[model samples]
Target chain A: MGTALNPSYFMVLSAALFAIGLYGALSRKNAIAVLISIEIMLTAVNINLVAINKFLTPEAFIGQIFAIFVITVAAAEVGLGLAIIIAIYRNRHTVDLDDFNWMKW
Target chain B: MHFDFSLLTTELSMFILGLATFVLGLVVPSRSRRGIGAFALFGLLAVLGLTVLNWDQQGVLLNGMYLVDRYAMFFKILCLSTAILVIFGSLRYVNEHLGNHFEYYSTIVFATLGMMVIASAGDFISLYLGIELMTISFIILVAFRSQDGKSLEAGIKYLLQAGLSSAVILYGFSLIYAATGTIVILEVAHATLQGQASPLLIAGMVMLVAGLGFKVSAVPFHMWSPDVYEGAPTPVTAFLAVGSKAVSFAALLRLFVAGLAGVHQQWDILVAVLAALSMIIGNLVAIPQTNIKRLLAYSSIAQAGYLLVGLVTASPAGIKAVMFYSFLYVFATVGAFTVVAVVYNKIKSDEIADYAGLVQRAPLAAAVMLICLLSMAGIPPLAGFVGKFYLFSTVVSGYLWLVYLGLIMSMISVYYYLRVVLVMFRDDPKDPAPIEMGSAANITLIITMVATIFLGIYPNPLSEVANSAAISFFLK
Candidate 1:
């Protein structure tokens, strides 16, 4: 049974997910895209947490608990944050960040 | 579960009080904004009192990630009091210039709660949660006006950097967990102490610093401050400048100094380098600023550099100096901006030239402004001076050059500060309004003035408390 899972495989998955999220977060201008990137990044964390918890130390259940909490937080964060974004979009008529120049001279 | 009713009461009350402001905002249907301002002040004062009452009480709560203790209690009181002062001080301005004053006060309360959580966070879970809560709230607060493009821009800019920093931080978190198999800061600290310092762990630490650096607006990561300050509403900018920075620094102090105390030598050089860069770039760049907000933005960044001196040492005195500097930084910046808020409200501009003859129109505001800027310049008999003296010496005890560079930058700040004073006193106001100091704003002015000068002259009481608090974690 111990023959199936290796730590590096999980590490590679987490690393790829983190990089993709990093790219999306930095390149995307839309608020939603940026948030999606944040979600991806968060999932990347959970992946690592779960992977390490299962493979590295069975005694340390702390990382598993942390992963669960992070997921819940991410969900809640996106929900509240998106609602605000929608409100801003409704008032301003555009979600494009460039159009969000209310303070600019 | 023995319910710590009194302990839970403090946190719950903040949330309830803030929500009340929002609810009352909708239900009251009264145009008298003063009533809401007073309520907000009273709520914050109550929170402050609770923080003091439980100041020395230490206990673990919420899965041990969250802590309620003297250390956290001290900063809880600080954040609440600062919020109260800022809210009261800007009461009239909010009614006149800013819309949604109730929402504004409520957001400050929520943001303060987020900061308090960070102050007491005992583990990485709470730390990240607290920081994110504070950050997201600020993004909303910065763009509260929604229509202002600068506010929106500031919000988006902060979001962009903050987003990247979050990833970096999370990556570091994951990597650290990968290396040590734990995320609890105390547990991780224990692991690192016995384990070999691998290159991987150090790399993660570097990434972690990158993320934290952006939050604190330290050099190589402070590209956002000038624009953000220039664009966001004055009061929100004040919060970003002081409130956010203080909270982040509080968390950083705990994380780096306490959780990772065993590894101070390893990180000292890295942080010292960042400190030098901040002092050099923050001061020199500030030299050319014509806009008062932008100048202060750079000034604060430089002040961040000076405060890093205290971090470099990580001694009892260093921690004490750091906390003192943060308090001074928050109050002085808020105080300075309080007058700036008034000037901006009246003149509708933040250029230094607009403050010319501010003394004629708003003598009290001008006087407060003078004291704040003088304090910032580290002039004698001002809290800023005392804060800087202790902070720089903390670095100088070993790294003599840090103090030397700090002194040069202090001289550099003197020029801009005086330029501001000259404008305030020397020139006549163009179409000055009969200077109206709202009672709240006037009181904030007086509080900041007295606190800055009084603490400057005799810092014994505060210094003693802060010193003990700084070393409190280790000695226990």
Candidate 2:
């Protein structure tokens, strides 16, 4: 064999992507940006699942199946998120997380 | 593998009911929409009856993807009863404030379906799907009053926070699957028992605790609740408090006790810390809230902390305590929020001061609110006290510190609860006119109050049921 690809490399990449997405989700001011960051986080999770399925659990496709379900559910989540964002924007004319503070303690 | 479709009678019936309600809402004229609420109510009652009838039946479906046992049936009963009571309480509110009564009722049914699904989930995929089903329906319901800015804001807030938490949970599930090479919860337990503890499994377990902690509104992850509670409609808030929280606990128990039992030593202390913090922060923060809904939100956070004590023990007795507390909690919370919804309808305000001298205006509502709040405070001869006694007793040996903290927090909780009672009973009403209540609201209030008091006085029946449920959980 010329070279071997280690599953650890994919795990590291997935972890890095997850960390970046988490940071963006917490720090982004725009509602849409926060949603995008959530999508990125979900994508990272999917990557992790698929990589694990390919390496450790090659006989069982459970991880890949789970990733598919995640993708489908993530789509539905984003759809609802965008609809709510639009509804709020229509009322308040802003998508800034800062402006959404109408009811705080 | 053969599928036993009959095992799914309750869920199928509930789904059909939701579909029927939605279709009827479309076909019927707007003038007759009020009857649909009653339609949904009776349908839920039927489903509740079915679930209770199937209480003793036990089986696993699809190689343990769906489970039908007394434990799952117990939660199914809780979720169904909560939905029924909420619908009965909110009938007038939905007809008056919300434009689409059918959608409101149907979404509640769908949300109940989601809770039932979570209760029976044997695999991670079903659990996630059930949670999303419930959550997505709630998102629509929260924003039902689309014209109101506050409602819209609450919907967005719930959507974002809930989405983020779900992603976190899914990531944890992925990690757990990677560690065990199996997604079945029991198989994961077996794998953990056979293999040495690895960083991958430990990290996954911690993530599971954190994500489920958010769902249960434990201290550090409880920031989303007060805002969502205050901004959403009162009935939705009540459903969130009773139905959503109870079912999340069910999921948490299933995942932690069933799937992660091999690593119980690793997580027990972490859970104990969460329980302590929730009891402290949830009670202290509640004292300053002026909105009755927000106050209830914080009290519920405290209640979540008390419920977590049972999980910390990870024993059959602990499971029984959680189930018992959850059952009584439904009545007290629904009773309080029914009064809130009715009062808000009349006064058009949620500020605590607006409730001054409520005893003079609506004696029954005021009395029910007082009793419910007291029950939540764990006062003697109340359901909450018995519930707390059971929970705290389970940890007497290892978690004695938690019991002390719980006692002190219960005392602190009483102060805030009594503040509301004082405003309702002692102070003068701003408007001296008596508040009128619909017959439906009256019935709901009376049932809840009776249940709360009766359960406190005679806790045997429900506790026995919970005992059997807990036994079934371990038997599997």
Candidate 3:
């Protein structure tokens, strides 16, 4: 309704959140922490989708539907990621990304 | 709005086969799990036949969410055939190295189904879901050897990187939706054509390229591939090399050519840059690798670069070239990795040096490896040479620079490929023990080797099919 709460404002917020999440995902040493940062990025995507749906195309709810799919996929990804991390932990007794140098990166 | 279920027979059958494998795996005794691989193999073969039977059928379903066309059918066949060959070639490897045969076979089926779905996806939603299905299944398969630390590490690395890339892709899709207000690809193309190019759309396009670039293992985003290939079981690496890369290219062609044709001028140069970088970097990095799997991994990256060269042209000829190359690539990769899997099962080593005197030990394996690697190196009178000819020929008029670079990089690639050949032929074996080959693996080798040579000599048939498939892409 007001310019203060417009689509551009929401877009900017989403962009900021996405950038922060990307930074955390890249810079974090812990595998689980990196997974959480990825979740943050997906959440930012959800916000962007819903905001765009409400402000730009209310007649069609494709963006909102897409956001739900993203949430579902992100949950599955985190589940698999954690399982993999645990598997590595059992073998090496560590979950630090730096310890994953068994193969040269 | 009645849908034609017949158009989906291949996909539905593949899903049911996967479920059957999983459930049967639970009921069957561990000692007899080898039957499950045979069951999976036959089931996939049946699905491959069904896909061929439905080759001419084409339709749209769910208001553009799903599509069935010759273009999609071609990729479906590729995915199914690749799955079949991988299973056939690695039956012994799976029984020996992997603990759960049922889960292994079932996940491969599901991943193949994902590739088929991605091939037929009409909109962004189906595309994203298909990609996740494939990636999640691959993550599990990559970590299937839970006792092996390297396998686990590769799995975790793939998980983190794939998760981050998918999120970036999702964000890009959201921005594109915000700008165009549609997720159906055709409608999005229409909207984009009508509207002025905005900063939102441009940013979205860039992000999309970056994310998919990771999936295809193009340079700058290819860091995860060599590690994953080296650590994952040889069979999984083979499938990842052929099936996954081909499907990603399929999705790229669909998105860039059909959905984003309106913004061709904006993204073509970006794709060209990725292609040049991947070709140069992938070939150059491959030369120094000692591990056979990692060497193929880098070679596959370079192949991805060559495939991207087709996308740069964005013409019917370009699509045809990509399809032709992808089909032949499946054979070469499966042949090469089958040799790797068989050799690893015997010697328990993937280093190129271990393959010394391989010709005296297992001549079929040695010869298949030689032909497959030479084909990938684009030697004359081989399938890879013809595929590269088509690809480079498509961009010869305008992108002469790419052609020159491709020629130089391909020559560089031959050096590494021949290095392995030299080891197999020249060096003496440390053990000098003969390796036993499985009947199934031998069959796979013969098929791939024959197909590679035959297709090179007679490229007309496959090229005709590819031409028709490419034509169908624009018929929509």
Candidate 4:
């Protein structure tokens, strides 16, 4: 609370966190891990937006509003997407992406 | 405040048409789908007439978010024409192959509305809304046939990519607004030029380019094109290829070319690289495709690259070239896809070998395919040739190196175009295997054929229209 991150620091940290999340999502074999990694990426974006509003753009809160919107959208996506994944799993009984080759090239 | 009801009327008719179709689709039985389509066609024609009537309004509407200039007006007309033709040609195929026919028609109307909104958008806010509307509708359309796992995959991939890019774009907008203290495009343009480039504003501009570039399927962000196109219904693929791409290009024109005229130097080099990669990768990968739709999918990626050449020039002539190329491309690309739809309707397969002996079996359809293919290959006396002519000439005027690379891709494209023609003309006809296209599809094919061959030979009026439409983008 005593030391708030500036816009530049937030942008750089957001980019770094997003990159790490992307790597984890791509390299990991666990499907649930990929979902968790995506959550990490979304949180990074949210933190960047909130920090930008707090440090730089005090007159406007559009960034924070959009951040909330993103959170809602991410939640909805995971809810529906996970249900589909479970359906695929119940039918195929596998959670690894290699087993999800029903739609590949 | 000149409130032109005419401009409002054009968009209003289209929106009403969409709503009416949605309600009718819910109430009416599936067997009566043709009646709903007829009503949809009537709606499209009404919008077309209204757009033509206000063709010369050439003024801003809705407090400047929507510009009714000839440029925006012209592209709106093009999008509607393309949508109507897509619907017309695919009626038989959609009913036979696709599961949900009524919703397809309704979403197409909605997508067309999005394109019109984009063409008329004058500010970043409107542009963002228009693009989102278009993207969302298209994602739904792409996944319309959810029984197909490929379609579901395409939808998920597109949604994820589109969502990430939209975030980048939203951040760009926030940063730009903060730096300039205005969200209006023109005001931001003025401020960007008057003051030195700030770190936040320039970063925002970069993010903006990334976002729009993703929508247009430019390089580094075009990973979704091949899968999505191959997965969707053939007619929806056509709409995505021509309709969605054209709308995004229009948005790019409004934002990068018109709004960011002050920062041309900053974006040109970056765009040059994007154009180069898209052309090289798109054409090269397309050469060995056995599937016709995927082949055209990659060809579309290459086409986007060629269109990017004109965008990179950053001159009035360059903008005109992009406009003309887009108009010309609609006939060629859409025509090519329409032919695919006919073949898909008949054979129920998208393989190139399925097209063998087409020339002998369906002479009229094969001829349309030839014209469309050669037109795309940039052969003379077809629209693609003239479109490339304008684009290359503009690139030469400013960027000599890009022209060389662009022409190389053009030559490379010949390999794929000719492969289709070669199979059609050379392969022996199979026994009891000649496919027949529906009457509606035949008619759309004929119109596209005429537009391609005739427009290329005598491109005066169309070229002038493209020039004047582009000039309006520069004006205000």
Quote model 4's iRMS: 3.9
Model 2 shows how many backbone clashes?
0
Residues B292-334 of candidate 1: C-alpha lDDT, one tens digit per residue: 9999999888888888888887777888888888888777989
- lDDT at residue B272 of model 4 (Cα atoms): 86
Q: Predictions ranked by lDDT, top down?
A: 3, 2, 1, 4
Global lDDT of each candidate:
0.80, 0.92, 0.93, 0.80
Off by over 4 Å in 1: A28-32, A76-105, B1-5, B30-34
**Reference-based lDDT, residue B181, model 1:** 77
Report how closely model 2 matches the true complex, as a DockQ value.
0.86
List clash counts for every candidate, in order: 8, 0, 0, 0
What's the TM-score of chain A alone for every prediction? 0.89, 0.97, 0.94, 0.85
Query: Which pairs of residues collide in model 1?
Result: A101-B149, A102-B148, A102-B149, A103-B148, A103-B149, A103-B150, A104-B149, A104-B150
* Candidate number that wins on lDDT, 2 or 3: 3
lDDT score at residue B164, model 3, on the 0-100 scale: 92
Clashing pairs in 3: none
Error of 1 at B155 (Å): 1.5
Comparing 1 with 2 on TM-score, the higher-scoring candidate is: 2
- Per-residue CA lDDT of model 2 for B75-171, tens digit only, reads 9999999999999988888777886668899999999999999999999999999999999999898888888999998898888888888878888
lDDT-superior candidate, 3 or 4: 3
- TM-score of candidate 3's A chain against the true A chain: 0.94
Clash count for candidate 1 is 8
